[model samples]
Target: MTTASTARRPRGRSPLHGGRFGLLAVLPFIAFMLLFAVYPLTQVVRMALSHVEIQNGAFIWDFGTLANFARMFDDALAMSSAVTTAVFIAATVPLTLVLGTLLAVLVDRSALFGPIARNIALWPAVVAPVVVSLIWLLILSPTVGVLNRVLIDVGLPPQGWLGSEAGAMLSIILVDVWHWTPVVFLLVYTALKGIDDQLLEAARVDGATERQIFWRIVLPLLAPALAAAALIRLVMGVKAFDEMYLLTRGGPGDATTLVSLHIRNVFFDRLELGYGAAFSLAVVLFVIVVLLVSVVVRRTVRQGGAAA
Candidate 1:
């Protein structure tokens, strides 16, 4: 019996053996982070705490003050940039989510056009942001532009899409929405595909109307994906610079001056490297905090849904 049992025993590697290989695989990633991410982040922190000046073509760092950070409180441009950033986020994130979700549902349900629509929706995301901005710039230009020409042909007055304060902000917000809504659609559509059809069939059998089934079953199932999309767009919105910079250059009159643009201006335009570093650090911290809060909220939501 002992001999039979010994022969029947299956041989397999222990988890520790697999874990060692996993560790070895991750060593390169760890080294890369230390070399790139950690090193640069340390340098940023050092610069943030110092008073940096260029003397004789070399940077002189006086590492003894919090004036850079303190100046943030009194800087009017910084305050304005913060408000602009907030408004940008508020305007873009929700529109992106709602439009994305709606598009995703429409595409998912349309059998004949689903594949075509999916491919077309991904086009904006694949195009470079700078290229997108350039295309929109021509479209929104005041004179000799396609949009203005169209408006004139329609017997409507041509408006300055990017030449007024409200127009610039609205234009940038619309551009951001156009660019990112596709990404959110991709996320929500993928989630929609993963949903089991049996649940819907069962709901239909139970006399649930199409709208009721969607609102009751499909939307709940899509909650996590929606949350994930929102978080991604939130982070992207916070760091948005390229489109606004290319389209309006944070104008007209600082209307589209996001925090990232403000930081860039401080660093390169004003040559206030230390203050920019401090501001950059603060933005990084804010992003981190937002990420943490989003994670907590998502978890709570998931738990609450499960409980319900």
Candidate 2:
């Protein structure tokens, strides 16, 4: 009787055992964030709130001041940079989305040339932004540029693509669109591939026109992917520094001077570390707000899609 009761006894795990194992599994990631992300952010906050100076190869910090942040209100260049960033985002994001989705649809419908076209479209995304900037810089050069040469040969005058305010802004916007559109295309194309063929077939069987099927059936399914792509592009646009920095260096009377470039100038050119840190924090706050809005938008899209 004793042996039978012992054999039938329930076996249970201590609650702490699983918890410990889970913590152990995530320990490396936590350590990585602490060492790389959190620590640096703390330093940035410290710098932002202090007056920094270097003397005799040593650093000094005079804490307890909001002067750096307060100066932002009077900083005309910084305000202009913000406006330029806004313009850049407004132009690049929509163009990238529309062109990318169109290309994805074209590739999806093209049975014979789909694979080849997909590979070609993905080529620009694989290239580094710095390299893309350099390549475009050469192509947009007023003297000896292939584009200008073609224009000259066709009885058109050469234009200074980066020499004027409008031209520089437009050139950067176009380059950015060219560089990032491929990313959106890949995302939308993958989403397209995941769509059920039977759903489309059923729509056709119901006598729905191709346009109607695309607008009513296909687009609704693709909403989540579109929202995700837009979020990614918006964030990337906000932080975009490489191409603009390398290609134009915020030139043509500050027309292409984005916030990122402005922050860089504060840190290096002006050697205003404290001010730069404060500016960077403001940008971080902006990014966080953008992320929050994106989350809300994505959730709403998902809920709407489920309802449909």
Off by over 4 Å in 1: 1-20, 304-308
What is the Cα-based TM-score of model 2? 0.92
Q: For residues 47-161, write the lDDT of model 2, one tens digit per residue.
A: 9999998788777999989998998889999999988899999999999999999999999999999999999999999999889988998899999678899999999999999
Q: What is the lDDT of residue 153 in candidate 1?
A: 96
> Model 1: what TM-score?
0.93
What TM-score, over all chains together, does every model reach?
0.93, 0.92
Give the whole-model CA lDDT for all candidates, comma-separated: 0.93, 0.92
